[model samples]
Target chain A: MTARRPYAGLIVAEVISDAADDALVLAAGMTGRILADLGADVVRRRGRDRGFERSTELFLSRGKTMSNESTGELLGRADVALVDGAVLRERGRAGLPSVSAVLSLFGGALAESDRPASAFTAAASAGLLAMVGDPQREPLRLGGHQEAFALGLSAYGGVAAALASARPHGVPVTIRASLLETLVWLNWKAVPLEGYDALPSRTGAAAEWQVLRCADGYAVLVYQEPDWPRLKAALAEPALDEPRFATRGNRLDHLAELAAVIERRFLTLTRREIHALARQHRLPLGPVWSPAEAFGEPHNQARGLFEPLGVDPGVQAPRLPLVWLDQAPARQAKIAVGAA
Target chain B: MKLLEGCRVLDLGIITAGAATAALLADFGAEVIKVESPTYRDPFRAWSAQDEPDAMPPLFRATNRNKRAISIDLKRPEGQAIFLRLVRRADVVVENFRRGVMEGLGLGFARLREANPDIVLASISSQGETGPDAGHVSYGSTLEALSGLAWVTGYQGGKPEVSGRDVNYPDQIVALFAAGAIATALRSVRKGEGGSHLDLSQRDLAAFMIGDRFAAASQGEIVTRQGNAQHHYPLQDCFLATDGIWIALSVPASALPLLSDGLAVGDSDRPDGLRKAVAAATAARSAGEAVSFFVALGVPAAIVNDGNGMMADWGEAWDHALQRDEQGLIVKGFPLQVDEAPLAIERPAPQVGAQTCAVLAEIAGYSSSEIADFAAAGIIETAR
Candidate 1:
């Protein structure tokens, strides 16, 4: 039998909020658990007597190592320190000691502090301390679970980037792909030059240039003006010649009318029937598949995009961020702390 | 100084996919030289930007920060020659056209490998280059829907609501991952092992983000929508405070009493006690106050903030924000701090073809006359 090789390992100091909400705990716990799953050594320094359920270990923490040491004690030995300043203060600790890096898991005044004192030593913020809070809401607090996850992710990214640049012989770098920045970057921003602050709008289920639903499933499709004539012929919809539906513009202006026409046309046949129609016309269309549906899709299964993990029998995770090297197991269990 | 102070990247990307990857590299201190076609400028110059032809577009500026740009139309034989020359001297090349586009342009891997076998090439596309769907065209939205992310984004009782108007943002996230991967690959190449082509599909990666749910779905378990309702605890959800602020709370089952006692609400034993207590407590206090009080008690909670506020706080409190140039471009700098030295922001984003003449003259050893002739032949577009 082959011995299992751990992928990553590190200890961490985590601070929780007093009278905190459930979301924050789940967020912090889940984040730590996921890292542990990825083979990292994860220890929770719960200074204020907070306990994590073993059930969460089954579901979220997986194979991670857990502890109830003071934040100060954990910080001295940790490679990464995730601090919820609100949680630290709840224990009535005056301040937190600094470590190599501090991930501000929440926002506000503690988020405002560069240095954190805990059961560990006094942290002077020698490393790249990053602050990430969820900015989707009107006003934000620290340790909003999902937002804390966002900050933790950004912290992960910053750490990854920082390490990438540390070695003397490799391409060096510093990263700033923050969660908040990521949100802004993701947003369809208003055009700066013209003050147009929107990207496109949502038009549901109408495959203007995508898949359309049929009786059984869906078929992906595309429509350029060249394809329009072929599509009209295939659907046998003479109404396309009508003034309101003739040009792309007129049809776009009255998408509701066009959608109604297409939906009614689609309802007449099964997914196979639509696939045949689309294929014969050489339209760009595919079936609308759920992840479950995708698992069974002949094409997906054939392409080697799914890999099974032992965590769940008959459960295969999608392979992505595809690497040329042999696939490593997805970070499944927490690495043992202080283990080689 | 930034950690990547002396590193140089040769960028052959256009539009969102490849360019965004290169942009991130530039953000991290890699000197990215954006290679473009002298004849047809970056189409994003026309379509994506809010600026006129003569001005820089905000889309371009946002992503293209801290990099130099030069025009060399690889389709033209001379342009290909110049780009190959640059590749031999660069650390990486990022491109996102269809699979055969680079090969068709005559600057394919074989030709470039002849110049520098170790030069890293990152091929970003809708689907991977060798896959069946490699030829497919994808913007962000279509890619999102195809990946099953959009299928899971809506409310419990409603159809999945896609956020934002464009393709899902996972495209950029994938792009970031690709950048990180290529950078990691470059490390291998520098050790004399040679570079490897990274085949990253946006669809494949975005699917991984929702891996936990997918793991269950594979085994006949369907995870449904709950609209901010947590699976573990009932009260762990986003709530609307009286100030019209949305605050998210995550308290353990044991801390329920602490919350009840602090807010002067009924104990957790009451039928609707925890819910009513939480609502009243949050309502009576400002979002910030509620957050502060909770933090003092060692609970898990946070308030959602906006962009300006986030940037503002980083600028003011956290010393993480980079200083911008007069043009408001984030100056190039070291992203990480070492031994209390603040990361330095060195240079701002460059203009189109800003260093064409200088780079060609200094690095490529092209004389003024040859450069002028190449310029006349439309081989390289000069800076305005």
Candidate 2:
């Protein structure tokens, strides 16, 4: 059976549109498409003579149709506005009153402020950079516009919630999911350490958990004490039987040594074998798949997780992330990954 | 002025994923019944190992605000019977139990569907319900690792560093998606479309978040960590300002003249030179001064704030995002604002089962004596 398009018929056959600035297109426009996939009549209104990066533009427009309607005209027709702060700055909020909900995916309060609000700036301002890289080295940005998707997803909820609660007495929803705020939310588990004597020390390639190299590829493991014996059995490594690797604390004390033993054992097994063993032992382990291999993943394919972007038969371009089984997004050409 | 003022949700969440989902709905004015157990409450309640008894943890407080609480012993037949009645009245049910746990409790989707045909059942699990590894145990971090995020994070040439301290980034991600799904499902039900099960896999969501990585990986390309460097020019990376502060930016070649080394870096076209030149140019200025100077020239630039930088008040956004409880604790703000609807807790998260009698009397039509009987029989507990 076809997945249900839960958004259909709620908004008069659907009404959705986005008109974000060039820099903000990926997040705002992508959010529009996600909403559109849910049966909203989504559209992207380009600026009067402005141009955009083709892939970014196409990524946003792949499933949804496009219109050159001015920002004002689009907002007049849209039930939900997936707006960019850049549009608010350029066009002003005069046109904003018509839409039922507004999800601003850029600098919210920071839109007009001196502080920067791009994904980079937001990440920095939120102190996410403090926890991302090595303690001794400079902060590194995560690959791709990592902050954009999170911000976009939040914007979707902001807009969805607005639509859900609209009434004569209800307030129109207006959410400004600051890139800074989302990043702050991302690091919520790390309690604020502003005045603490100690800050989170970065551990470059080292983390409390890791994706270790296996004989053929990589493995994802979440170490637990009860599973140590099972892990030892899976690897059949005599070294793992020692008392030093017996308990979680002991393993921590001899982490390097334990890791050395595990790494050597992993060298003898392929990723597939490791996963099989993980399942057998109920170990919290999985293979570390590359994007290339993700499409062919047995589980994902069986679940229909990856859809061909329909870009080409030979050239596979996987669709965008943020899958909803109810309303899977439209197929698009594989995005030029890592493209700024 | 609440947008979701009439929507009623049954929050059967235990961890961050389930709780945050319900919280998002509550933030938007949904009447969320945060259902916990008297014996086995949401682990998030005593989140901090050191938290005082009966005193809620900050994380729990932040995510659980703006919702009513009802502690029912689902393991008991009477409690499950009461919950089934709630199922008939609720618009949605959000849960993150291990697979089949609900079925074991006789509260599975099929069973709930029989009770309320239009009920939206959002089931969040580690690896989705249909996958080969569906039964595998995982935390938010484990899902992060399996999704290729952990492999790609960290410094260039460095091993993958797990994202977040103890926070499972995927849990929150799943929450956002789950909320959206529930909203859509509710809309569908309004249009006469039946409610359906929403099976969201934390692992799938993680892979989707880093979707571009998969695009690159599709061609046998593995883009390792490149600290602060975008796929474009190296000049687009982060740099240190004169006063020991870090700044992040990216300027196209057309605007190269805006930088002090515009001529040299533009002409040389070298990553190392660009990095050096940008650092050299801003070496004497403080981070704020440097960023302002760039903004003045219409360049996108910002200071790379560390933990210390995140401390400043959030300005106007804070007015709508945060609320304070009677204990004077400032809870995290709802990420969204519905025009005049600034979401705040009607009552700080009801003490576990604080609303047991009110809920039972109101929804299940339970008499006061029945509530007392249940409490006496260990079927439920009410807050003192």
Candidate 3:
């Protein structure tokens, strides 16, 4: 038989928070979901009145069992616990498991501040809001609940490391992960580069790589220095042969004109055609596919990348993004969410 | 005590995805030795500052701190022998080269397991190690485009937008997840399981981040770009204030009454009307005043901070994500802090081959004369 999943016998407790912030709930719920996917027994404790969007609930509550056990009782039996700052403070260190990851809005010096915050506000504070979109317009937040989910990723890493080193009856450890810290960590390039006085900002039309309109939808024009020759050959337009677009520096100096020349060629081709050309030339071009359209993509279908949600057979989510080469491919047993 | 005090890792990682993962392991107290070749240094070392050869680029310094550096030309048989010797002493090896580079160098998983049966080899790539498009060339935004993230991330009815070269979202998050997977594999090794190869794909991870959208779409739900309008929030977007600063505000349904009373708008029941009223009210006051007002009333609001504004709120909003080193140079910091065994920057980034002599003598069991011979034969490099 194949070796057991990594954390098969591990038990995790996910504490619920009554606060109305979506970020906190998502972070805690996501941490539990990751451990559950790794074969851990995750028990999600529910408060009487807390509610989440149906999609969020369906994605996060997979492979988890709803529990009515008190926080203290759950901690007593759990090998690990995922909690928010408020819950951690409410229960104190005495009632926590040997390994506990505390999710908070702000950590370190501002750990106790009760300022109202959401994923949007956290993104704004972390300088992530200033990185995307048109420079002339207001900066845009990323597509989904990225800030909260990133915090969940950080917490999971810390918990995994702690679990790797934990002894049978070792001293307890508290892992602190926060929304602001996690966002900043992801956007670390926003911090001024060493020896540079000015910080990097959004480049809009000036960026070397950009999404241009195609016959169907949109496709990003992407190519590194080495792929420049192939990109020019694929487009096969005379304007690209202009002296002004001879080198990377020259092309940057006339980025808009260069984009116009390429986009003129792209507007006639569909996204699939562009993708096929990229594959042929070994270029890094990417065609933007809506979630609905992505379901039918040949690559995704071939990889079997998505799995159906247990609660609703019609719904599906991406499987865990890792594959162990040594083990046989075995589907995870789907556990339905039940009432506490 | 440090969490991973006794763990030894041979870092064959380069650039953001691989190097940053090793850096996190270093932060957790693992002994991570960064390996490069004299002819092939980490491209990040010259990413920016081509004009001044001696100056370390910010990206390189930020991702490579807290580890010692050694140079080995793995292409040569002698160099491969030395690397296998080091591998024998190491518990893990991490790399993110294009799909077949390691195999071409003859240091593939089979060879690594031959050197040490319990070694954990983490192969991080743009696609997976065994897919039809496994050899596809990609950057972070390219993966974002292919992974269905950019599709849902834009103004309503507008074209999709990437985080661009500056933010490269996939490269950053993959490091976090890859490090965790390595740790889990280490746990398995400690439990007597044999060696394993971890296949981590950035494109797959980018899709996983937006997994809920996929779930909805697979169920025949039309999951199009909704901009900043989340279903749970009545109104959420950025508005420019009188002082010329943009303020992001999110209003929950429960706060509709309070928001209507505060802004004196009778049309708060409608989402569009509430958004217009909030925009109008925000445009009449300074960003700080508007943020404070909404926050006091239990609404989520904040000023959209640029880099400088982020530095201004460093201590209060966040403290350790970006930190100052011994010489007051800014470096990458931790995403999480352990209360008992807090992570820290023990040393700054090293020069190429900075610890070659010491590592060869101490860990690889090479004597001083053998190291001298290797240097003479051009198989290894020592820091000048």
Candidate 4:
């Protein structure tokens, strides 16, 4: 196990954020979390209260080793330093190690000083909001600091690439991941209706695909063109037998009628019933569970997605989403890393 | 040299989740070849609407750039043999299929390891492998709802909401997470360790965002949505300006007068009044301008911008990345930059099977006669 862990005990100096000198973005913080999840000894300076809410700290600070050391002392011994571009410009990359890898999210392309604070506004400013959600209404942001999630992911990939490229030799390298650019990259992927000049307005909220109320809660139902025959079979309703529901465009045209018919049918079933039907029909439909209710989910339970956090018996550590076969230090990684 | 210059990746990803993962590796200088079959082409590949002769869709081009394309039919033994040989030479294989689909097709991790003892097989799925929901079908929106993102996203009083359009954030999350996982696995291999399967769950990951809700709920706190607010702080909120622009401010009301000299709340202690006053103040300027002003003054401010406003904020960089194709259609490039070293786009997305013969010959060491014979035997498609 010791032989397998090239990542084990890698000291990552995280130049953390605080309220007095707030220099953190949710996306950028999430980037640090990504490295921590891979078992880095993340050291954030203990400072005045963090600029973010306790929730942000709890989410970002989990799995990190907080410290009171000066940033200089920490970075001197650290293998990786996660910093935003502004920090690099101000501090210069002089103190970074010969083998050090720096994962950075650039300051705003417009005003370098204008670091984004909200995932919603950042996403919107990136043109991501423009292409997402209902086209008629103001662009809809997904629930939570999603911009953090987006940039954090790119940061995670950048850090991972940096880690993989790390060597006993070579000059320090800086990997730059963009927040606004990442948002732009993700928001428009489909063939834009407006061609390349601009992102076409998203269609209205009411589409062929949506969440419908079930007996217990809500369930998302994907009644696409491919699933029409099987969906009609599962709905087993004569109301949907109309010629209006035949083609994709017609189905969109009569989406209300179709939704009403499906909603009524769905109302009679629990989320479990819909899951079963979805599997049988090969359609993309499933229940929508709240975070609390997710604990009872059979699949999550089986996968051991959540581990006990030790503070409370009822509380569990967030289930890690990525399993590394490299740092076979983890229980799952031993078998996952093929040497078995 | 680029970080992953020597790495080779076989991407059997379908949606944004898989292509985006491969795209990351490609951007970092890995040789990532997209493996798809005409019979099972990626669902997102229908990017171009009209028959424009392989004019890639915007989404497809954005996520699938920096990699070559090849098609292989795993259903047929000959194709599987070719793919297995590719796996032997490949360092990483990434696929977004639901659990057991690969095993069912004899391309599961166990089989890949048999072919190459040091190959990392990353299975990117909505629910991870081995769970009851592992076999369940899910899209990004459904995952959003189930993962608790929907429950926490809407306004303080509004019901749980999803994207109005099918904009799934979890898919992108899975892509990056998987890419990182693959890179991690690659590091172990670089150090002479064996490769293993990476089981990444997008559903579990997206749900992890609302982990704070779990802590709050566990403490017997009834957590509801905050909309543009946080922890029920009256001052931390988003308001629509008189001119119809939206901006979010996280500062308390007490600091407002000091932050902006002209604005005065005048005992607007009530939440509604404060909101109204803030709205009035913001309405005087454009959303982008207000954001810049507040940011300059050390207040966290952001305007709710769309595609147009986004370009306005990040103009030159955005303009440089978003280029015009031969048809003058705006196309985008990879956003991640590695200083002065060029992260080369080896080629545009290959037409399915366009590189079948070439990849098989170059990577799999298949002879021309063997490739021609395989094509003759109906095991591979060498043309569109």
Put down candidate 2 lDDT per residue, A48-165, tens digits, no spaces.
3324333334445545766766667766655556665555555555555334333343334554353333566666665666566665677766555677777677777766666555
Which run of 10 residues does model 2 chain A get worst, by summed lDDT? Answer: A331-340
What DockQ number belongs to candidate 1?
0.16
Quality class of the docking in candidate 4, CAPRI style: acceptable
Output the number of the lDDT-best candidate: 3
Could you give the TM-score of chain B for each candidate, in order? 0.86, 0.91, 0.98, 0.89
lDDT of each: 0.52, 0.65, 0.84, 0.66
**Model 4, span B290-340: residue lDDT tens:** 766666655566766655655555553342334444455455555555653
Instruction: Order the numbered candidates by DockQ, best leading.
Output: 3, 4, 2, 1
Task: Write the residue-wise lDDT of candidate 1 on A86-188 in tens digits.
Answer: 5444432323332223333222244434221110000001110111111242211111122323333344434434433434422222222222332333332
Return whichever of 1 and 4 wins on TM-score.
4
A1-340: candidate 3 lDDT, tens digit per residue: 2333677788999985776367877887888888888889999887644345567778888899998888788877988888887777788887788788888888657777888888998888888888888778877888877888888889989988887773434478789998899998899988776566667777777777778888888998877888999999988888899999999899979988888888888999999999888988989998898888877777777777788878566788888887787532233322211100
Kindly state the fnat score of candidate 4.
0.45
Index of the highest-DockQ prediction: 3
Report RMSD (Å) for each prediction in the order shown.
8.4, 6.0, 3.9, 4.3
TM-score of 3: 0.96
lDDT: which is higher, 1 or 4?
Answer: 4
Instruction: Write out the backbone clash pairs for model 3.
Output: none
TM-score of each: 0.72, 0.87, 0.96, 0.89
Per-structure clash totals for the candidates: 61, 8, 0, 6
